[model samples]
Target: MTTPATIPTAGDEKLPQAAKQSGQALQTAGRHTTQEILTFTIGKEAYGLDLLTVREIRAWTDVTPLPNTPPFVRGVINLRGAVVPIFDLRVRLGADATEPTNANVVIVVEIGDQLCGLLVDTVSDILALSDDAMQPVPATAADADHNFLSALATHEDRMVALIDVARLFNRGVPQVSEAA
Candidate 1:
């Protein structure tokens, strides 16, 4: 909500180099280890996640509704034979529901032993950010949105909020039981 993420234009040679380098806070020689972040948008605002957690990125598709769940729970989609639940990132951030369209995308991510997809407006840049580049979320941001953001960092004059995967589902994904 602070600022919309700045996306790199095509033909920018720097992007490839940034994308190639990434990690999950790992240590490295000389400089701090880089964390590769996958950036995406929800409306105009941009958000990012540690690339190590991402499973894949797929086009938006209709999902089968579940009986009882939160409004943010868009429903479940079939990924191969596996049923993956999709969450509306907008709603999760306490914003309006996203009107699904062909342009939308599902970012499949794995947290611990669980797997799920995050529905967003579109996918953008993969940034290679060093540890020192990241700053803790400001204490002034005491709102519904603050709980979800782990840190904030700038990439090309744009601010990208690093989402904490552990807090996305409060550390536990819904348990889907088998139907006899």
Candidate 2:
């Protein structure tokens, strides 16, 4: 394997004497030694998300369906007086609409500036993984659903697809236009 190029840092001798000592030139170099993930199930598949992004996990609640939105958009719920859109994780991941039951749950997460809830079959467990345990999604996975998976991690004989919440919301899709 080829050695990666070394980025110049504030401590590098090549920098001007005064510039080398400036803290602005310090290279931001730190790896997450350990990360916590919130694991959930949709269908038979298990998935995970950065625990830091998850605000709360609530039992499944009936939502007020909105007209003219995508099928995957399950509609909004009253979250402490704030209307938060709830996305069906199954449908968003290209599966059929989930038939929510008492066991189902809604994972409230803050994606960007918006707070939305993801409907999942069940909240499984909290997983703690080291940085090295995360593997990049294969380049061959070019499907819409797979694109939302940022990484894969194995937990006790099962592989969990690590969902990228940001990408999950930002995927490019054809826009619906109103016709006169």
The residue-by-residue lDDT of candidate 1 on 1-180, one tens digit each, is: 599888544344233343335324544566356788999988888899998899999999999977678888898887877788898988888899989999999999986676788999999989998877788887775645457688898887889999987687773246653220
Question: Model 1 scores what on Cα lDDT?
Answer: 0.79
In the range 4-121, model 2's lDDT, one tens digit per residue, is: 9996554453543322432212222252345678999898999999887888999989998877787888878888776788899898878799988899999999777667889999
What is candidate 1's CA lDDT for residue 134? Answer: 82
Model 1 ranges with Cα > 4 A deviation: 1-23, 26-28, 140-145, 171-173, 177-180
Q: Highest lDDT: which candidate?
A: 1
The lDDT, on a scale of 0 to 1, for candidate 2 is 0.77
Model 2's C-alpha root-mean-square deviation from the true structure amounts to 10.2
Best by TM-score: 1
lDDT of each candidate versus the true structure: 0.79, 0.77
